[model samples]
Target: VFVCKKFLKKDGRKVRKAAKNEIMILKLVSHPNILQLIDTFETRKEYFIVQELATGGDVFDWILDQGNYTERDASNVIRQVLEAVAYLHSLNIVHRNLKLENLMYYTENNHNKVVLRDFYLSRFENGPITEPCGTPEYLAPEVVARHRYGRPVDCWAVGVIMYILLSGNPPFYDETEEENTDLHNRIIFCRIVAGDFEFDSPYWDDISPAAKELVCRLMEVDQMLRITAQDALYHEWIAGNGASEKNLKDGVCAQFEKNFAKAKWRVCIHSCSVNVRLNEVGNNSSRGILEEKPDEDQGLNVLLARNTTQQRYGPLKLFPSSVPAHCHSACPRRDPSTLPHFLSLDYTQMFKVACSTPFLLLICTSL
Candidate 1:
């Protein structure tokens, strides 16, 4: 993965602690749906984590690349996610930061296999975890409120991920971009706290009620009543209805694409690392940046079709177009200028700064 050299540059101790936590947590887990930690090494100046190569890209970009996915596609993905989370809970480990970006496919050839990665925020839980952390949009209300929480937080994020997977947009999000972000955040927080959101048409019109019901249970505001990952795996929607592929209607696809395009900017911001990939996968020779260019707002698949990196990995051979102008090289490089500057903010302090400040500020402080 693309660890910023700024991590060691800031504080060697905290960096080492983070590395230990990641490695320890990863070592405890062994499942196909979870990303495997093969090895880890540290130079005097930086750290490098060797893990599974999710060549199919993350779920968000994968949706864009595939245009629109069916319920079966989303169900299969959610099943793997739930299974992984259940396994983690069985081991008393809580993945505090579970989002679309953290879930990826092993390869384009293996679309059904979704692997969960990023263990920096994960920890072994005995009771409540009081850490106030995680991505803003996916943060459970309890987390945002800075209350003691545990495994349920991951379940909440899974619900949000499932909603986006099926509909191409988050259930709880800003109503409009007119207001300043702080105001928008307040609105989002209030809705999440109140459990106020809807599966509005035409995105939800084509989606099965069983799927929506599961989402409702998972995203329940009351943590005590929310569905656990193990129970979620047995939901009818996940176990039975996901048996066949049902094509999404044309109008629903149009609506989802439109909504996703509007929210694409936020997705880009939350995607902390763009050029991170397993060296085991594609050709490591050609290096190119995947910046968003003006006058290129074509359908993702249309863009992929024209730019075919290869048949196996689709168009995003190097990186997704969502990658900002300043991130990893097409091929892995040790250039300090392209790396994110890591701030040694403690978890609680980081979360506070994240909620009140710009999203870019949050990225700047990413552990």
Candidate 2:
């Protein structure tokens, strides 16, 4: 295996950091579909990442020899590819560069297996990333546009891969050099619309509906609505399960719900604060009572109150009236004994407080 390391210059800090991060992410990821990183080293000029060599070479070479891969071959390759992607995304990593050339085939015990290779264009999910990289044909709309993108870019590339694998052609084309660049630019900005491609061939007739659905969903211009890698893992075609079995397993569903609950809680708290501020603008406001404009000392007190309340009652929903009561009741004038008891009350008790005080029970829910 040959490794490239010309990305370590002082001006290449970003590239170096990205390489290091890719190595770190690769080390943490283990899957049957991923090519293993055997070893790594660094010279002053570059970093070397040694990966297992695929004796059968890249998918592009294989396709060239065969002219076009059969549907079964495409399905087999795509299944492995998606499995690798699913595993990477589970670890919050995105393989931003995905194409036939990046897929390698190796023989193990005389059995052929496909593995995903290349990580120079990969990224994590911690923050915004704006590096323009990846081959032109597989570049996502957002990636081509030089916009901050996350894991969804990987999904778009997956769609492109699927298109090439099944149809033996890319979804977009240009007759002129200028038009080719313009088409790439348009793809980057998500200006290309779906249903623009004609697929009247008999080959498309045998393609499964699930596979087509997944491709369309993954290639969606709207990043927010794009199928996440995790969700795609459970997709009907990829999973080989019917629509009814497409739902996540019970345990997985529970974990998903838990994460959603936490996110919803944060949103609820933020919205509550905004609503409180808006309500404070009107007369007969409870916002003032909630200590909306808290001083330093009051801020500390409010933190203590929230901590104590959470410890005792879990997450307490601060209704309009409940907010003021919770904030004011924690004041020095209130009895210390009552404060401890109130803090110990559960979310149900907090809900009761909101219900009893109609003013506090606005549009807010326990979210």
Candidate 3:
């Protein structure tokens, strides 16, 4: 099956430029771990990009309270991403954005290969290209400092990914007296630019020292000293016995559920293409996609095929007094465009649907 991504020309120059960039980058690489572009067509009002469909969910989908998870499992995931980055670097192509949200499994199976997706912010690096564009949490030091940067920026992001994968918490976060998205982002930026992060006592205690060393090397503040993806692929944790066999499910799940519980359509799993996989698993319940309209522009899959990054996304607020908490996952009146305003909901019911109740996996994303 294939996923056809649509971009309304009216979305403006930023969207058009991103579409152009994504097409160019997909055409330039042929790797097992990267998304491949198949065909492209454009109309006066829009552009359509038909690419191979990855039926598996994003990185977090496989790790959240997933059974039998371990440090070694996280290592395997990182190694695949490093291999993809290593290939991109060899061509001098820098993927400005690299995070858990952008990484997907080729299928929902336990042994599915990890595939790196999303390349709209990618560019061919002739030198230290300077441009501040990326998810706030995953931004590299040079990007935040507004310094000219190159491929090492991607490596720093890899470190952040590794850190999140191993500990279930972001390396840099806001803990000040005041709190809000804007302020939280600002404080996090300060921490990122200063390379202020820690393995915190309890989180790092059971984690292997070699794993910690690799995280530090990948996330080094000095871009010049950051470990390259090609080099990182050979790290002890990734290539040898550095990763411990100890199961990290308990601690990792606790933090992941708490930290990311607020983000709704914000996690970049925007492609409706993932819905096809859900249907295959007989997930026809209220928490599933509810219906399937695979034709382009027909269902949730095609509507969110555009650049639905975190910047355009906000936390899932759930139902308000106006809307009932018992509503189905795919309410008929619920259009993708109007879903964001409907985010306010019953917090208790939402968690029950998400955690022990049924893992309320709302793959729904909004702009």
> lDDT per model, in order?
0.60, 0.50, 0.65
Best-fitting candidate, scored by lDDT = 3
* CA RMSD (A), model 3: 15.5
Best by TM-score: 3
Q: For candidate 2, what is the lDDT?
A: 0.50
Q: How well does each candidate superpose onto the true structure, as a TM-score?
A: 0.67, 0.56, 0.72
C-alpha root-mean-square deviation, each candidate: 15.7, 25.9, 15.5
lDDT of 1 at 186: 52
Report the C-alpha displacement of residue 305, candidate 2, in angstroms: 63
C-alpha lDDT (0 to 100) for residue 136 of candidate 3: 67
Residue lDDT tens for model 2, 21-44? 667876877888887775555556
Better of 2 and 3 by TM-score: 3
Ranking of all predicted structures according to lDDT, beginning with the best and ending with the worst: 3, 1, 2
CA displacement after TM-score superposition, residue 215 of candidate 3 (Å): 0.3
Off by over 4 Å in 1: 1-9, 12-14, 43-45, 242-245, 249-256, 259-367
Q: Which whole-number lDDT from 0 to 100 does residue 192 have in model 2?
A: 33
| Candidate 3 lDDT, 1-367, residue by residue in tens | 3444555566556556766877788888999999787666666766555566565666775777468788899999999999999999999999887887678788756555998876766889987775555666787877656568899989998999999888889898767734344455556666787789998978878999999999999999998889999999999999999999998888887787666552323322232121111122112323341234253322111112122222222111111212111111111112336645224434333333233221013323121
Q: What residue pairs are clashing in model 2?
A: 5-46, 5-47, 141-188, 321-360
Which wins on TM-score, candidate 1 or candidate 3?
A: 3
lDDT for model 3, please.
0.65
